[model samples]
Target: MAYQTFRQEYLQVPPVTRAYTTACVLTTAAVQLELITPFQLYFNPELIFKHFQVWRLITNYLFFGPVGFNFLFNMIFLYRYCRMLEEGSFRGRTADFVFMFLFGGLLMTLFGLFVNLVFLGQAFTIMLVYVWSRRNPYVRMNFFGLLIFQAPFLPWVLMGFSLLLGNSIIVDLLGIAVGHIYFFLEDVFPNQPGGGKLLRTPSVLKAIFDTPEDDPNYNLLPEERPGGFAWGEGVSWNC
Candidate 1:
């Protein structure tokens, strides 16, 4: 009964969000069960290129430390913003969304070479939040029920919160950089005078991931509400 209900709800989540979030949760659970360790997950260039441990590239973005306050906080933000982006602006464009993921992950991996950061899941989360906020710049956001600001500042606000928590700001900054790069290339640059679309989703991805418009069985999710939340809605930070 409960399991059936849970399965139905889970299936309702947009495909990209469902797959990515499920991977993160399962990776964490693997760690919790002692089947995996952070040592095996953290990104290491030497192992990746020299010894060919390629899975670390993806796994590093999966584990967000142990299952506790920090884990829950990151997961909430990740799932929330990721889902909002998919069902809102990127709705019916699964291939492009997946392309964005590949693009952002590639940029982060390149940048990770110069930084001392281990895991990058938080940065990836920030990139999603950043992109969504840029697309919905007018939406008001409330941080911790205290500070209220426009959507554009949400990434910085999260960075500020990270600083307050004694976490390195580097990760947040990395996310913001990659997010800005993506937003500018995809949204801003193409609209400028004499500027053309710089980011194009490969046709292969489209063929593999995007559903055909002529398909009679295709069902699109309902359009998301403004800001991905109701007006006057409070986003509680339980940490």
Candidate 2:
């Protein structure tokens, strides 16, 4: 009975989020079981371009190390914000969400070529959080009950938290940069005087991922008001 309930709830997650999160989990599990090594998964340009190990491009963003605190933390944030974004602003736009994933992943891969960082899964998670926070700027968040701030600052706060954990901030910064570029292109710039849409979801993706639905009454989830709780300590808040 418990397993059945779990399966039902898991199946309820939006498609993109469910697939991405499940991939991350399974990839990490494969590593933990010694079915694969980090060398096969990390972003290595030489192995990818010369040896034709192109799978590295996507696998590099699938593993988040072995099962531990870092893995659980990243997985939680990844699942939470990814679901919120898919069900909130991108509710009816699965194709566009997929395009955003591709765009951000491609940009990060390009940046990875210059940097020595491996396993971009965490950065990708940060990008999701950053985008969601930007779109829901009015939502209030509490960080471990120690800090209270608006949504826009969530990404920076996570970066700061990473610093406190003795981890490199470069990954977080990269995610923020990519997230900002996406937000500016998709949300901010188009609203300015004489500005037009710069980032468009390719028709191929739309045809492949989107279904024809003409719901005149379709409405996005309403933004949650301020005074919501934090995401730390295993507590999550809706935004």
Candidate 3:
């Protein structure tokens, strides 16, 4: 019964969010258990180019350091905002969400080459939060029940909090920059006069991740009875 309840809750999460959160958890657990080392997962362009350790490109965004305060903090933000975005504006649009991931990852990887940053998981989480917050500007958010602000200010608020924690704001800034670029191109600029859509979800991706809309037999919900009553309603149960 306990396992069944867990499964029900887990299955309630959208597919992309579930997979991303699971990956982050497993990666952190692996580090905690000494099954993997941070050096092997961090972003190192020299090793990536010389030793051909290309996995660093992807793994760098999976581990948020050993499980602790920072790791837990980042994981919470990542899971919450990612799930909200998936279930909100991006609902039933899996392909576009996947495209956003790929686009952001590519841009971050390119920037990581120039910076001395190692793990980018935190920055990636910030990017997710930034995008979602911008898309839902009017939504009110409270930060640890301390500071309350509109949705769009959440990322900046987090960056400020990181500064207070004595952590460098570089990673957070990188995330904000990349996120703004994506938002400007995908959501903002496209709506301006003489502007057009710059990001397009490919046909192949749509075919794979998006459900078809032309299913003739598809029923979203069961049909109701012809009248506002159920069959045999008049024949009440006899005690």
Q: Which candidate tops TM-score?
A: 2
lDDT of 3 at 114: 90
Model 1 per-residue lDDT tens digits across residues 112-141: 999998899999999999998887765778
Cα-based lDDT for every prediction? 0.88, 0.86, 0.83
* Candidate 2 positional error at 13, Å: 0.3
TM-score of each: 0.90, 0.91, 0.87
Candidate 2, which ten residues in sequence have the lowest lDDT sum? Answer: 225-234
Question: Which regions of candidate 3 are displaced past 4 Å?
Answer: 213-239
Best by lDDT: 1
RMSD to truth, every model = 3.5, 4.1, 10.2
Worst 10 residues of 3 by lDDT: 224-233
lDDT of 2 by residue, 1-239 (tens): 99999999999999999999999999989998999998989999999999999999999999998899999999989999999888777877899999999999999999888888988899999999999887766667888878878888999999999999999999999999999998888888888999989999999999999886677656433434311122233344432
